[model samples]
Target chain A: MSGEASKAIEPKVLWGGGRSPFSISYGKIMMWIFLVSDALTFGGLLVGLGFARHAAVTKGFAWPSSEQVFTHFPFTHEHLPLLYVAFMTFILIISSVTMVLAVEAGHRMDKKKVAFWLALTVVGGAIFLGSQVWEWSTFIAGPDGDITTWADNATLKQNFFLPISTEGGHAILGMEGPQAYAMFFFFITGFHGFHVFTGVVFNFIILMNVLAGTYEKRGHYEMVEKVGLYWHFIDLVWVFVFTFYYLV
Target chain B: MERDDIIEYSLHSHHSAEEGVKLRKKIYFVTALLSVITIIEVLVGVFISRSANEGTGLWEAIKMGYIVLTLIKAGYIVLVFMHLGDERKYFKWMILVPYILFLLYLIFIALNEAIAVGEGMKL
Candidate 1:
């Protein structure tokens, strides 16, 4: 009956499936669809985080200020809030730029330039991952090495969740009141970090392909463009993660 | 490869040297723009105090500023870096509309949930 109805109506050829109306390849279109879905998943996690933070704030529970908790900079004794994260953000942005360059090089069939830029992108991704691991370790260790487990609630409460009023602001030094902050921090950034890890791996594989002249034989570098889209999506996700997780 | 596959593969030809240079320059400009915005965001986050009183008007404004700036950065990444801007309009909308609508819905739900939680705590 549905087929008869469609035959009677005979809509435009756009949905006839003989050709793509989008003028792009099927693979790229599929990539975009996958990315949109991934965006929703990440959005859900971030919104949940915001909800938790708001609830904590409403309950008069001191939320762990990003300034206080993320203050430690490597090899520096002084408190520096958001500096290391800014550095990592820059690294990711630069890597994104390199990825675009690689795609452009591929467009021109410049195999050498494509390999060069892809290698740089891989390095940048590796560095960002290293920074995230260091950050996770520092957070888990706590400032005074006191926040280990829930069993050590007595000392943990005193040392880790202290809400001391500092000269800068109302600083909640460690995990703060409910300890949900640390949990959210771990889960969200850990998820994004895992993406970066995969991105690095994918980029390395593509670079190897480029070096082996695989795309050269195929007469196109569409694989690089595809991976470049994924890489940029990773960077795009980081922009939101940085804003929600650290800045706001 | 199939005849259609051969025809569909990379319809655009290689860029000339000057065109490549121009493209690289645009990429650098975008990189610089993103970096500058990120630095501003960091400065605002670190220097601006969110006093003991949560949900002050000023703090809310700053939060909004962060979101707007992040959106701008995200736009550049998607449109320029991902080459979404170069695609046809229908494809662009098909890819972007769902994402925009979903994110806006999530943000709405988040705000409402927070408000409700706050009100509950008051009671």
Candidate 2:
């Protein structure tokens, strides 16, 4: 062995730093980078939401409880607090699980299993997207009530206690409200819903590729794995969105 | 290479029946765990409302709990579904540290600005 180490010359070989130093493939790492950037964007949205909400509360505006805002389920005349959102969240999470299974099957080179699981994942994502649309409609339509205006531009449009409400609860929110919470809610959640829709489309495309045996030709399921990364990120973001926008 | 092809049939089985069954079980376990946590989160919202309805303090406490629980779910998804749990420590930190720092900075800045705005509005 040489007594002294060789001079640290410029890398001329594989370690020239063009390749991933990490154990993972470059594509997966790229996805991680994208996700990190996406996470920051979401962080900004949520922080902005926090600022607006805090200002609303400090200004003595009534911010409606999440339970009140998300109580409705399609075709259900009952007041089920957070029922619809809980269902939406569950459906999204289930889709994530299916995505995980699809990726796993890809790793196993099980084309039939991969296609089956990816199809299910696509369905789950579509259902969640559809649910988001329904929830958005319900939100925009708002509770059945009359607008009672106050000084400045604050308004509280509240419907009588919804039947599914555990206690007599009035659903209160509007543009003129002290906080205008509805605006922030619509913007942030709509942005997230758009993401979910895109994810659904992405999953559908990946599913088609799986069924076509594209990865089978390559003898690797890395494409399925890559798309799984994306689907999982969508699920992750929704957790934060759910917390900040609804439960919090 | 007999032919140039876009896709070809797989000639190998990558997983055995037993392994497939085990993986299916794991998938079911994760789904059940996630669903149960969601249900608990919902039930907490519904049942705890009685006390939370009594006071703002109680309501805030419940919200804090909600945040903690959501973070748990988020972490679990990353660890299991994203398979980050099994990654090297350095890799985990590389991915997680930036997000943690960003969220903390956001919370600090937003809350501070909110307080400042509140004071400014107190004309």
Candidate 3:
């Protein structure tokens, strides 16, 4: 093969104003920029979450354990703490792996392999969405036992002495304003989850295109690379969410 | 470097296609190591919670430790798994430094507000 012909086989460098030789597609570069902005948005939300938590602390409001509020599963009376969320985390990680595989296939110009991996990524993403729905349902359900909505003037002593379940499988009284915290949790996490849901659908469309040999005929899989960036960004966001919302 | 030169260099450095296989294995190893650290963190958090129900100063310290460890894990994910470390230095700074600064600002404001509110309750 001539030097030019051999060079044509190499992947094209996309953006970066010729400052770097890093060979990423233009679509992928744009996706990274988008992800940076999106990351900022999530960071703001998390900061807001932290602020709310701090405010509750300052107001003499005792915060409920995440284990207590996130307890309970749909279609069953038994309480399963953290299991649903753990399952969701696993699903998202698996989907991320599939996405990486798809990107790898694209590198080799294997359209069929790319399509198969993308399909798997889409399925993993759908399972993650379903898991999120289950998690949200459990979150909205509140505690397993009798729940009381306290008045604003309810004394700290009374509020703190109120019985609440801990993640340790024991009940302790004294936490306060769990409902308020729950509202923030639902809103912030639900927003992130919605983003993931949209990403999955978008990825599925790309998968279909690959299967139809559209990208193969076009001589590039930049679209797959672009969606891969988005998919990875979602995974990145989840890492933070899992830490702050659950573990922390 | 020219496109052909880059490819030729990469292939030459590898000495064979097996290098790609070796690189993939390294990636998996790193990923597994990170996952293990995460599991350890969860276990530590659970253990700390069990013994420190009263929210003592010691429990607070443990919570801080948990938060720090979580940040470390996140940093690893971004730097290693996301290939941010392999990118140009400018890109790395562009993505990471701003995030760190913003996160610190949020933390500072949150703690300050919380402290202010706590003091107000005592009045």
TM-score of each: 0.86, 0.81, 0.76
Q: In candidate 1, which residue ranges exceed 4 Å CA deviation? A: A1-17, A142-178, B5-7, B11-13, B52-54, B121-123
Q: What is each predicted model's overall lDDT from 0 to 1?
A: 0.79, 0.71, 0.64
What DockQ does predicted model 3 obtain? 0.23
- Output per-candidate TM-scores for chain A, rounded to 2 decimals: 0.83, 0.80, 0.77
lDDT of 2 by residue, A136-195 (tens): 666555452122222222223463221212344743333323235566667777788888
Clashing residue pairs in candidate 1, if any?
none
Q: Over the stretch A1-248, how does candidate 3's per-residue lDDT look in tens digits?
A: 01111232223443334423343434445677788888888988887777767766666666666654444566687655555666676677667767766765565567887889899999999888887776655433434532233333232222324344465876554334565565567777788888998898899889889988887776666677678768877877887787778766
lDDT of 2 by residue, B1-123 (tens): 666432121222245567767767876887787788788878987666632473578777777787888888888888878877645455678999988987898899899999788667632
Ranking by lDDT: 1, 2, 3
Q: Model 1 residue A92 lDDT?
A: 97
For model 1, the docking class works out as acceptable
**Which candidate wins on TM-score?**
1
Candidate 3 falls in which docking quality class? acceptable
Give a tens-digit lDDT track for model 3, residues B17-39: 35435645755765676567566
Candidate 1 has a DockQ of: 0.45
Question: Which is the winner by DockQ between candidate 1 and candidate 3?
Answer: 1
